[model samples]
Target: MATVLVIGASRGIGLELVRQYRAAGDRVIATARDDEGMTRLRELGAEPLRIDVAQPASVSGLAWQLDGEEIDVALYVAGVIDRGHATTPPTQSAFDHVMHTNVLGLMQVLPQVMPMVEATGGVFGALSSSMSQIGPVPGSNSWLYRVSKAALNMAVRSARFDYPKARLVVLDPGWVQTDMGGESAPVTVEDSVYGLRRVLASLGADDNGCLIHHDGRRAASW
Candidate 1:
């Protein structure tokens, strides 16, 4: 069995990933920002680690906590969508928060956690969105979110060279039905995660730095 780490495991896709991983007999280290989330993760048999990805110190603390452990699959699933409507510009505060959490936060945590995964010759992945693409944009809504996720994709791709021993990729879980994806999203979290698990299991050295969709077979445009 592999030791998997799911960052931002409080709810939605993150929470479901923890559940599925644990149910599959993997040792999971799940992180959340709140006590409630921690409690729920524990109920599902995950070892909870409290973290606020927007804060560098919390990410550092997690690195310290896992200093000697070997991680097989480290998936960073924490992210936020733009709160403002498509027709209007997003507030400065919302933009800043999204950029910090979705982009800067991943960059900060990558350096700290990647070494652990690399030690085991494993893989690292971050949840990126297909909407991040520029050519023939999928939707005009959540412009800030789109921008932030695009930046996130670039960050992960660029960082791949720095961690040569571990395979790193950006994953688009598809428009999964989560709190972020909303009710109308076409893909259910279960279906997304199921395929995502297959995608993760199938990743190899050559697949490093790719942007992949949840179908486990297709590559997403950068």
Candidate 2:
């Protein structure tokens, strides 16, 4: 079984990932903002630690805590979505905060977990959205969220090259019906995560730079 570490394991895609990994009998080092909130993950046989991805101190502390643990898979599912555009002219604080939480956040997160995966010759995965694709040209709205995710995709691509021995999948779980995706999205957490697992499980060293979607298909720009 693989040893997996998931940051932002409190709810939504992060929470679902913890459940699926445990159900598959993989050992998980799951993290959330609080112990009380992540009790479900603990009950499912994961060791849940408190990690708020927005804080660099929390993430760095976690790196030290799991310094020697060989992690087979590390999934970064912690992301923020602020839907507004240049048209709306969002407050400076809101725009920057969203970018900080998503773009700058992912940059900080990857380095801390890379050592764990590198130790075991393992893989890494990070969630990106279709909105992030500059090639596709999304309709409207989601200015900051889309831009941050697009930058995240670039970060994943760069990491893929840097960590050539390990397989890295830059994933888009689709329009999932989680809190972030809301009720209107077509894909459920189960459907999205299950499909994503299949895609990740099938990857090899050559798939390191892939930007994959939930249905086992690769993204257009990938």
Candidate 3:
């Protein structure tokens, strides 16, 4: 079975992914910001880790804790969506918030995690969003989210080229019913994770640097 590391495994899509992977007998290492959040993952058979993705030292500390263990998959799910009117404080704060986790936090983990993933010939995934499209938004009110995710896609692309040996995947989890997405969203966490995990399980090295979606289709545009 594959050994997997799931970032942001506290709840919603991340938690479901952890559960499915563990149920399939994968040795799962899951991380979140706090003990309370990690407890659910613990009950689901994943080794829950306290990881604050926005902190560079926290990531390095985690690498130290693992002690050179090789992982078959490393999925970075830690991110934030800043909902605002594309105006003052809220948008500004949103930009900073999203960058701190989605971009800066990713940078911290990517350098360390990508090297380990390449060493083990593992799959490295980063959660991206269609809202990041340079084209136009399907809906309003997610301007900050759109910008941050677009930047994230670029970051993932860079990692793809940098880590040629690993299956570097940039994935859109779809508008799932989660805390960030709201209850009215069409897809469920289980549905999105089910498709995503399937893609992860089956991806080949040739698929590296690809942008894919929760439904197993290649996402169009950057």
Per-candidate TM-scores read: 0.95, 0.94, 0.92
Model 1, 1-222: lDDT tens per residue? 999999999999999999999999999999999999999999999999999988777777877878788999999999998755578987888887898889888998898889998899999999998888787696677889889998998999899999999999989899989999889999999999988899999987779998889997556356
Candidate ranking under lDDT, highest first, comes to 1, 2, 3
lDDT scores of the candidates, listed in order? 0.89, 0.83, 0.82
- The candidate, 1 or 3, that scores higher on lDDT is 1
* Model 1 stretches astray by more than 4 angstroms: 83-87
Task: Quote model 3's TM-score.
Answer: 0.92
Candidate 3, residue 15: Cα displacement in angstroms equals: 0.7
Clashing pairs in 1: none
Q: Which stretches of candidate 2 lie over 4 Å from their true place?
A: none
- The candidate, 1 or 3, that scores higher on TM-score is 1
Candidate with more favorable, higher TM-score: 2 or 3 = 2
Per-residue C-alpha lDDT of model 2 across residues 1-222, encoded as one tens digit per residue: 999998777888888888998989999998888867578778778888887777766666877778689889898888888888768877888876777667776788777788778888888889998888887775668887888888888898888777655777789999999989999999999999898888878886667877898898777673
> What is the Å distance of residue 129 in model 1 from its true position?
0.7
Q: Where is model 3 more than 4 Å wrong at Cα? A: 89-92, 136-140
